[model samples]
Target: MIDAEGLSIKIGAEAKEFDGEARFSRSQLTLWDRVTQMAIAAGEEAVQSAGLELGDEESLRAGAVVGTSMGGMHTLDENYDLIYRQGKSRIHPFTVPKLMPNAPASHLSMAFGARGPSWAVTTACASSNHAMGQAFQMVRSGALDVAITGGCESQLTFGVLKAWEGLRGMARDACRPFSKNRTGMVQGEGAAIIIFEKLERAIARGAPIWAEVVGFGASSDANDIVQPNQDGASRAMRAALQDAGLGAGEIGYINAHGTATAANDRTECAAIRHVFGEHADGLMVSSTKSMHGHCIGAAGALEMVATLGALRDGVIPPTINYDEPDPDCDLDVVPNEAREVEIEAALSNSFAFGGLNAVVAMRKWRGA
Candidate 1:
């Protein structure tokens, strides 16, 4: 459990503290919030992993798209505390730039010299998937040859924790997605960035391809602000399948947007069943949120990492902390323990507040 100024939750997964001075100059650190710093670090790692060199002719065709729910909660909380509690007259000079929703994207673009289509997507929990889907579309449509895309979040602040507590959607002990005994979600903070490149360009550069992004689909429920809609989720999944030119049966695994909340877990299961029909019986579905905690905006990107791992290593990550069977969520959840199974294709699902939903379809990369 994590306590924030006496407001505590059952579980909160926070990233290990890293030395900012080691990673950035003092001036750079002062200008960027933790969210933007984390984004820059993730972007750097992804760029290096892909062996991508920006700031050249290729950079003109590169872009950066990032996502976040609350961009700079820590900075806002601290500043508010200083002003309201301590009677401070002014806040940090860089507060505005650090707290802006697009700071992470803007900083990433500047860091990598990506001059094209740089922006951020803010769709609550579904931000990452929406952002990644947008980047995928741009690359697929020839609008850009490369995209530095993913999500970053550093929202574990006193005010943010209290706000989430007011919603009564946070778990008391653990995150147990799809389990009958599940309580609610546990908050997490982190970042994940991936490089998306045109197929020919990636092959030409001999970059290591983790997985192939085949399709993306997004839809809005237009039904509820907090409650999820099964029809909307099913439609998004079907659209992704259609765009991928694949049948529902072709999807071997699903990285579910299972928040461990009672409504979300049950609703997501119903949506999966509705979309997959009889094939749902054999599909291996799991929510990595059980292990990583619900990362909010970064949830989809982290789950996508798990999905890619399944495709690459033939091992499906488990939905940890699952205690009992859930008849409503009867699909194979691979609960408690990891399972070794070869999966050719998978889908990562993200459903957010305000009924936004996004799904991404991917397959094991067979060298082109």
Candidate 2:
């Protein structure tokens, strides 16, 4: 098991407790990568929570859409080390199948017996939101009744860490978003899966309804690859508000894509201000990444877990590790401590590298 605190990298939110051997049978562990294992575990929990049996008829209409930035870094890294470092003649036979980007989604389909439509979305940090958006559109357009969607990532390998170090965007000690003294992002690993089904079907089955996925918006910067574009971020948020048929005033909280990098933090605040205008002052914007660390492709989904908590429990998760506030990110970041405030609507932001951005708008579910 990898020690989260004892890592040579200094800071990482690694899922150290994750063990495929303990969670699955021997045959199951051989074929699936750690990424797929996490995805399957999350998917199974979602299916059980949603009271979905995936019967023959239901399975025919159910589908899965998962997201990830790096698919199977552990598998690839281990095999590469064996070949190049140890001068091995051969690697695992299931290496290719386990490392493919679509492996999570494909494995999820087989696990749940879903057959309608299944695929994986890879958009760096915005991957999960994009995947969930695609699933939402499919269900809204009457293409499918049940959609299992989210993201998974387990990229804490030697090669991945070294590559991140080369980028020099990692904090030495901790993740402190929106803080003036913030260094950069801290890496994390995990998965979060959600089951989305028709409201009527949910009602008929008495399934617990959490929140309604109201709108989705996506945009590309088209200007820079590494740097974040404020204009592109603003456009995506504006598009989400328009799609939700909601005014800026209706959104009470915003789950920011604050990655702790100076450019990302400042750019995101500027975009929020541009989109929300005066309402920006009233928005309880916070970056859960401060606590969970940056999950890369799974960032949006993990933050969605925080966003849903705000909608359901009227408590906003704090942006912990905040020391000194930066003037550039002068927004209500709910620093250091959680706050209780009832909110009816909220938005989750996911702005990624390569100038990709995706936003999801959700509203509290009252009743039919």
Candidate 3:
């Protein structure tokens, strides 16, 4: 076995400080700039967390994979405004590069000097999971010594927000997942990065391992572009469990997709029922989107950060704004505040537009 171990995630500007849950940071700059800055800051933090120096031969052997759903919507919007309203003759030279979906990965690779492999994976909201899953394989197969992987997006621009509004998935107020009064997701912006290394490499370097990528499974519904497929999600979950060498009964917690949409909550609940069956009743399932809003392409990796925090701190953050429960989403959604729990292994589920379902299993790292 390749025994890849220890990962670190750095949250971006959208997250609220523990005490300041009501307010979030806002910037005059475009979302793409926010993503670039956050990636640099987080990448440095992850490397330091691993107790390794960037540009070191071993670290260079490490890899990078990033994902984004809408590429650079904000930048695109700004340029369009300049050209259309102001009658500008040409777009900025940096426009295409900065607005590219793969820009974040390119920036990361250049910053850290990771020479092994640097690429971006894009699949709507499932992007990050796919990136992380590929990184897991790279280390497991001895193709890389370590992997710095995650996803980022800044889709809160006018054009993107208008597009999401057309989808009718935007909540007028705040997200209320699994709640009877729930409406839909709120578009948010952010990025999250994680550092992954072989178990032996991390131990040799005395790295602090937060968790291990025990299992990962991904599948596409290809059934509908906008709607979710419960059957596809259930199959992916089962595959993740099997890959982890565990059974449904072994899991104590699940970080649900719970997008607060009528279709999403019900369909995801059905998927949970299909996979966990009787054990679903005992699982502490919740969606954190109620607190952070949905970060589109950035959602999966950011939620992965939350999952790792749950493992390290032994507490699961609640799905805020949950009041009256919907019979359709009748699962035990840990609502309103963080709670303590002993989570040996946990699942983070992300289902995106285009019926993409990605599930990953994580466990507290035990150094050998």
Candidate 4:
């Protein structure tokens, strides 16, 4: 089987504290491009981790996949400024290229000289998860010896903010996942990338095995464009568990799709309990969005990277800002601060708008 080897994350140049406290610097690009930069940084880091030379002709077999939710809104906004206010005749030639959702994948391919196949997969919030899943299948099918994959997004633009404001699901102040006081998700932007290689190839190359992709599950709610369907999400989770050849009890941790929205948190909790029954509570569950806010398409890759980090460091990043717990989401949300534990196998869950549900199962790579 193709194994996902090194997983890495690079927060955007305009870094924010894990706590959704405040902006550290005045952001320049649309939150999406900044996230693309983050994915670039992480991809470079992964290359370093894999000890592979970039732009090496030998890596022509390497491919790339990146996902983004809203691409180039920042550029669009700026171009509009020129056209309306400044009365510009024509937009810049780079406008389409920079604003395209596939820009991140294109940039990654060019930067790494990955010549095999490159593409961007978009499924709203499930964008990155779908991209990663596609890359996994490519590796498994022996299309390529290696692949660099992940997602990046920056939707915290003026236009995006206005659009999200219309949604009315965002919090007025802080994001509180699984908390009774939780209002909604605070906007976030970032990117993350992971490297995947065939397991035997990785061992042969003496690559560091961070995690193994045992299973992946994807499904569509086909119910609503905005609201989530618990049944669809539950079915996806079960399918992932089955693909992993795992039972509900075998999963020790669940990186939940706890977006902190009133509907999402409650619905996701129900889905988990429905699928896992009594074993649901036995698993350590938390939403890192409490610290990072809701980073749209990049959220899933970042969460998966966090899961790998948890496996590597033996520490679970806390769901900060979780003060009052919700009875509905009644699970041990490794609340605030890192927690130490043995996480043999963990699941990262993501359910996006339009009823897109993607679940990925990862096992800590133990040399066998």
TM-scores of the candidates in the order shown: 0.97, 0.97, 0.90, 0.89
Report every candidate's CA lDDT.
Answer: 0.90, 0.91, 0.79, 0.80
Per-residue lDDT for 1-368 in model 3, tens only?
11112211111224332211122234312233545655656676777776656556766577788877878776788899899989999986777877788878877887678888888888888888888888888888899888889888776565666666577667766789999998777667777889878888778777888888888888889799999998889988988888888789888888998889999999999999999999999888989878777877777888899999888888898989998979999988998988998788889898988888888898876567
Better model by lDDT: candidate 1 vs candidate 2 = 2
What shift in Å separates residue 8 of candidate 1 from its native position after superposition?
3.8
- Candidate 4: the clashing residue pairs are 31-154, 32-154
Comparison by TM-score, 2 against 4, better one: 2
Give candidate 4's total backbone clashes.
2
Winner of 2 and 3 under lDDT? 2
Native-referenced Cα lDDT, model 1: 0.90
Supply the TM-score for candidate 3.
Answer: 0.90
> Of the candidates shown, which would achieve the greatest lDDT relative to the real structure?
2
Query: Residue 52 in candidate 4 has what lDDT?
Result: 61
Evaluated at residue 233, the lDDT of candidate 4 is 94
* lDDT accuracy of residue 196 in candidate 3: 76
Candidate 3 lowest-lDDT run of ten: 1-10
Compared with the true structure, the alpha-carbon lDDT of candidate 3 equals 0.79
